[model samples]
Target: EDYRAKGFFKEALVNFVALLGWNAGDDREFYYLNELAEKFELERVNKAGAVFDIEKLNWLNAEHLRAKDPADLIEPLKAELNSAGIDFSGRSDEYLKSVIIAMRERVSFVKEYIEKSPYFFLPVAQYDETSKLKNWKPETGPQMLRLKEEFAKLGENPSKEEYEVALKLVATELNIGAGKLIHPLRLAVSGMPAGPGVYDILVILGKEETINRIEKAVSIL
Candidate 1:
């Protein structure tokens, strides 16, 4: 019951448990309840105790999690956020939907999805120190500052493509790799070294907030 409350999907659980003592005489590992029911046979059921494999369960859960529609996840996602003591107020439906889209492929559980990106809910107070030490350089601050200025010119609500184009243009102007700016910029906006595509995250965060974050990161350096 606690596991269910923690965001394990029912169909995924069913699919995993059914495979415990039964194999449908084939190489396939995934099947719906109806499909398993049609294939179940008393004689074919293994008499030995079946060991539970958590990896298999997680794999099944991942598939089910991805198959779900983002819209259907909103209420439960809000409930999870409330449980975590994160205020869901002021977040719009469109913003929440964008978050779901950003996170869908990144998490197997709803709770994991919400917990993995707290920056989505709150301002990134500080970046990951290791990422900063590894990725930041003398040129990083100035380049990001320039990138921030470029972003400012885009007006509000630029598409993800526009953000990428601006970043690459700045990198080209500077005659350095875009990665020099990108790595630090990611740390700035997300406080983590990796996440969904950088521009995708920027589009979701919007121009003003994104540029402010870049400026903040430049200040940090």
Candidate 2:
């Protein structure tokens, strides 16, 4: 229960502990509880001591997290959010699910969906210092203003593709690579150097919030 509270899935914990001093006489490491029951053999138990590998447990937990349906993660993720004192009252389940889908592969634990990407729930508190040094430049301010205009043209609820096109058009007019706008824009919206695709972040944030974040970044940075 404590492990579950801490975001380690029960199945993953079971799978990891099972491999401590035993193997199924093969390379396969993942198994369902039922499968473990069927495969366990007294003969395969090792005489040698087992080393507790926290890294392996983390890996297995991530694998299990990815294997489950994103919808199935919502309740537990909400629990984690509540425990963390994040108020998600206004956010819908479907919206939460989209966040899960976007961040699932990038995170190893349920809490990380919130930890690594708090911008989804709250406004950008602080820009990543490294990202500011690397992605934000003298020209980035004006470039972001122009990009904000393009995003404003998108109105509310623009698709990810539309956001991409808007960004590309800005890059073309500026006679710079798309990466120039992409990196700084990512910094503006996510306040981080990396995570999910920037366009996806834009769409998820919607038009008003995206523009507001850009405006905020411009003023602050």
Candidate 3:
């Protein structure tokens, strides 16, 4: 015998299980339990075996996760962060929600979302060496130093638009593609070659922290 077990939202589980051997006689694939109870009919159920599909289950889970209210999503996320020893004393509910909003589309499970996003809670301890070598050029140090200066002029917590404008202005003045600076700056802030948008990460990290990370990256180069 083969056995498998996992967790799911009650409503998603009910909705998923109800579909295994039944059809609603329409193309819709999602419904609330109450909606299912309202529409379910014994005559509509297929007599054939229904193989449980984990991929379909995960898709349903992602849909339900996206539909969740941010307030509803926050407490459990906080608990998971706490359990992982991530400090939340300085981070606000709004800040946490911003992270959840940014991440919800990219994750199927709450824990998976939290586990993959340590950069949200911790500073970039070290830059990725490969990215550093690839993106951090001889002239990149001066360009990043210029980025720090431009961002410092924005005071704390510049808007995303403001961050973009600053980086573009610097890139234009330096006569280089915005990507040249963008990739290295991402490595500076998150120590990764890739993740979220650079301006999104910069705005969330705030001006001082972003500038400081860039300075560190410049020193390393």
Candidate 4:
């Protein structure tokens, strides 16, 4: 932020990508780095930052993440984690897909998963119990149990509005504010205090995966 606060834009731009994700390889350096020598276009570089408007970046990152085969991103994601002594051993790419979906909101550069997210993605890693405790609650536990049953019935590609409607229903049944269901629900899915609206995450993850994560959350709680 300091270089950015100064007018060293090129340096700052180099630093900005470093702020969130990992560079996959030296083969491609155009988007935010070294490409200036041949491919740098002023139109491409913004003098001002978007300031982590995760909604915009989440959609963009998901587009990029989804466009690539799950295998491509998964191996890199696993390799990055393993180098740090994190584990993806024996965990299926299916779970990794859900982790990517869960974190799409919490990350900007997208590869932030390799660095910013270890607790949620890796196996048998130690984490801050206090942080996890911040979002888990007794009522939230039962709420998720019920949510699991509800979401378990959805099809492969349910819409966001479908999940929203289901959430509103869950809110009503629980006799609590949607904020209660949504906030805790989001925390449970992403293992973070904040993220994309919970409904959107559910929609992207599809129905079955959503239910599976909710079931996992209930068990953890």
> Model 4, range 1-221, lDDT digits (tens) per residue?
65323212343355335433433435442243453344544445545544554343344344444444445556666755675676567567877776676665555443577556554554323324564576567777888788777666666688888777777888898898877777667756666555556676666555766676677767766
lDDT of each: 0.85, 0.92, 0.82, 0.59
TM-scores of the candidates are 0.93, 0.95, 0.88, 0.51
Per-residue C-alpha lDDT of model 1 across residues 130-177, encoded as one tens digit per residue? 999999888788888899989998967899888889999999999988
Off by over 4 Å in 2: none
Per-candidate clash tally? 0, 0, 0, 0
Taking the tens digit of each residue's C-alpha lDDT, what string does model 3 give over 99-209?
Answer: 888778877777765656667788777777899889988888998999888888995669999999999999999899999989999998888887678788887777888
Ranking of all predicted structures according to lDDT, beginning with the best and ending with the worst: 2, 1, 3, 4
Model 4: colliding residue pairs: none
Q: Pairing residues by index, what is the TM-score of model 1?
A: 0.93
In TM-score terms, which candidate is top? 2
| Alpha-carbon RMSD of each model | 1.6, 1.4, 2.9, 10.1
TM-score of candidate 3 on Cα atoms, chains taken together: 0.88
Which one is best on lDDT?
2
